[model samples]
Target: AAMDIRTLTDDLSVTGQITQDQLAQIAAQGFRAIICNRPDGEEPGQPSFAQIEEAARAAGIAARYLPVTGADLTDDKAAAFAGLLNTLPGPVLAYCRSGMRSATLSSLAQANQDHPAA
Candidate 1:
């Protein structure tokens, strides 16, 4: 399936299977930041975090790697994601293997931020 890109909120853009070349394309298309949600070493042949980071930097975009595996989306991950979103410039593009995880993480982060502690 083609990669999906969606705006979960005003500041976050989520996507799937973003290549180094595609990162360049996204930069050209005016995206200012890129956040990678897939963990390194999960699957053989997946693009390295360094490769994407280098590409994003060369393209004049800020890059951040949060790297949440399928099993790692706990409260800690959600909190960290929220922290990153609060600091990173938008419109930020976050990606995972299928973008589902990226979108889920972003939504969870937003929810966590919206709710107050008891």
Candidate 2:
């Protein structure tokens, strides 16, 4: 499936399936990084991890895949996502099936970053 980049916040963009060509286009459009929120092997027809990573590398954009399941939104995941957000240059694009998990993870990461004591 083709990806649709939606701005969730100032620094975050979430999307559904992002193809290698789409990643390249996004890089051309000045996106700095990408995060994959869907778990590897979750769906049969999804793009492989290596394909996305190779595309990001070719496009000179940073990429990270932190697979998340529906019931696996742990604090560790949120913290890890926050860490990635902090490290990415800017305008990070996160993706998953239907983009729901991606958006949820990004939002939770931002919330966690905002509330240090939480």
Candidate 3:
């Protein structure tokens, strides 16, 4: 299936689950990094993080697996996601099962960036 990507910012985007075959297309779109926000085995036939990471490498895109569930979207995880955005090459594509979790995490991270703890 084609990627249903939604832009969150110039440097970041969120998408639904991607297949290994989609890596090259993602790369061709000039995305320099990928963040997998979906946990492995969330559903039957979903690709594993290891598999996605390997394919991402082959596509010349850096990949990080930062799996997050609804309950796991804590301040710490948002901080981690913010850290990845600070360090990873862009534009970065983050994905979850339906992209909502990834979008939420990105929003949290961006909010933290805008207003850091004093």
Candidate 4:
């Protein structure tokens, strides 16, 4: 279930997609949390957020479904994502269909209240 994960910063990384079993591997790799940017039923074989959440819970890693498709990406979602990161354990991994949405969101999260549109 391992995939080539892209580390974006000290505490953030983006991944294409992950399987249920990959949650354990993510924990083993020192990622304390997961943000699923991919929506449920996006693809025929893609695992749902509920399934991944169950695996993450069993692995002792927190997981949240913050799904965002390309068209749905917004500064508000990014800010919310940042808030989630601030509250969750460090070294979080955010995964989307191609990791692009997650990566973009991570960058947007770096913006602040003064420039939420950034």
Q: Candidate 4, 74: how far from true, in Å? A: 0.6
Q: Rate the local accuracy (lDDT) of all candidates.
A: 0.83, 0.84, 0.94, 0.89
Cα displacement (angstroms), candidate 2, residue 116, comes to 2.3
Off by over 4 Å in 2: none
Among all windows of 10 consecutive residues in model 3, the one with the lowest summed lDDT is 105-114
Clashing pairs in 4: none
lDDT of 4 by residue, 15-86 (tens): 988999888788899999999999999999999999999999999999999989899888888888998889
TM-score of each: 0.91, 0.91, 0.97, 0.92
Task: Flag regions of model 4 displaced more than 4 Å.
Answer: 113-118
Writing each residue's lDDT as its tens digit, candidate 1 over 59-107 gives 9989888988878887788888888887887888899888888888877
Error of 1 at 49 (Å): 0.7
The numbered model that scores best in TM-score is: 3
- Total clashing pairs for each candidate: 0, 0, 0, 0
**C-alpha lDDT of candidate 3 relative to the true structure:** 0.94
Evaluate model 4: give its lDDT. 0.89
lDDT (Cα, tens digit) per residue for candidate 3, span 22-102: 999999999999999999999999999999999999999999999998999987899999999999999999999999999
